[model samples]
Target: MVTIETPRSPRNRKSAQREKQAWLFMRASGVVLIVLIFGHLFINLFSGNGIKAIDFAFVAGKWANPLWKIWDTLMLWLALIHGTNGMRTLVNDYTQREGIRKFLNIALWTICIALIILGTLVTTTFDPCPDTSVASALPQFCK
Candidate 1:
């Protein structure tokens, strides 16, 4: 008896492209995160008044700036995507069952979506002073 070997389908090629894209994203996001994270730390910890200067008022001031908003937004999105995709890779590697892999991927994406939504809302809709009645408790700049 003779056995025949079948060629890979287009679906396999598409899957390969997705894998390559994921790998490329991992490397690119890693490089970007390093720069953004370090810049964030340096600005917050080593510049000007340094860590001691960090307070509710400081954060409020940073958020007031559109540039910082964009910076933080980019950081949030890139980190979440990078981390989720990393976890997805891990799940694919370690999970042997088809069902388990699918479940985990769905769960990862759900969490990522939740986080992205929550973080974006918090960053964009942040009110420095929600209760204006409590003037003293709020930041000095709030008045």
Candidate 2:
């Protein structure tokens, strides 16, 4: 026989609504991630000159454009948050200890926020022209 635990309070209803929203978000973000991830791989690894073409200048050139910057930023933020939420769900389900589950979730969010902040800074603040020792082979923008 299967047992179903029923919610007994109004707070449970609010939690149920949030849970539904999270489920929807997971589905939507997953679909978006498929496109974003595949497009990212194809563009970075298959298009243009291919894998051998990736270098500091390649990254700098790519981030120089606001379009690619936004693409990458969206990809990073979506993937991180989606992954964090999934992990939180898992922890809530699997961990029997409330204290342990809470600690894990707190750690997950802290790491997620830190990564998002760092990634956004890197994506948006990237400068195509940076002072390098090898000025001879530098892109014209750097010269």
Candidate 3:
């Protein structure tokens, strides 16, 4: 018969500097996330006509202004990156298989990159009233 001992908790071999930097990043990102989340909510859910104010025209109006465009772009990138990083941390902590962990991390980052690119493009270049040299009856505003 053989007896096996359970493995001890993983030890931190990282240097103090590296550990400190990681800690700092987590804290900073967390703080920024709070601000971003709240501000986004306040803007989208409380301002103007509230959620009902969200229309193609409203989006176009927002992008027409540079400030809203910047705000949206920042929010998109920050939220995606922050959420991805947090998920990465969770996966790292809980995942026991190296192969699965690597695959999940790759997938997470890939999706984040793809979404960020697509979202940024959409927000920056969205046109509510598409260019139609001809006339059409859709929304009077679009016409």
lDDT of each: 0.90, 0.89, 0.78
lDDT of 3 by residue, 1-120 (tens): 888667444457565566467668778878887887788788778977899877666676667778888888887898888788889878877899999999999999999999999998
Residue ranges of candidate 3 with Cα displaced over 4 Å = 1-20, 131-143
Q: Which residue pairs of candidate 2 clash?
A: none
Local accuracy of candidate 2 as per-residue lDDT tens digits, 87-117: 9989987888889999999999999999999
The best candidate in terms of TM-score: 2
Task: Record all residue pairs in model 3 with backbone atoms less than 3 Å apart, i.e. clashing.
Answer: none
Every model: Cα RMSD to truth: 5.6, 2.9, 5.0
Ranking of models by TM-score: 2, 1, 3
Q: TM-scores across all candidates? A: 0.87, 0.88, 0.76
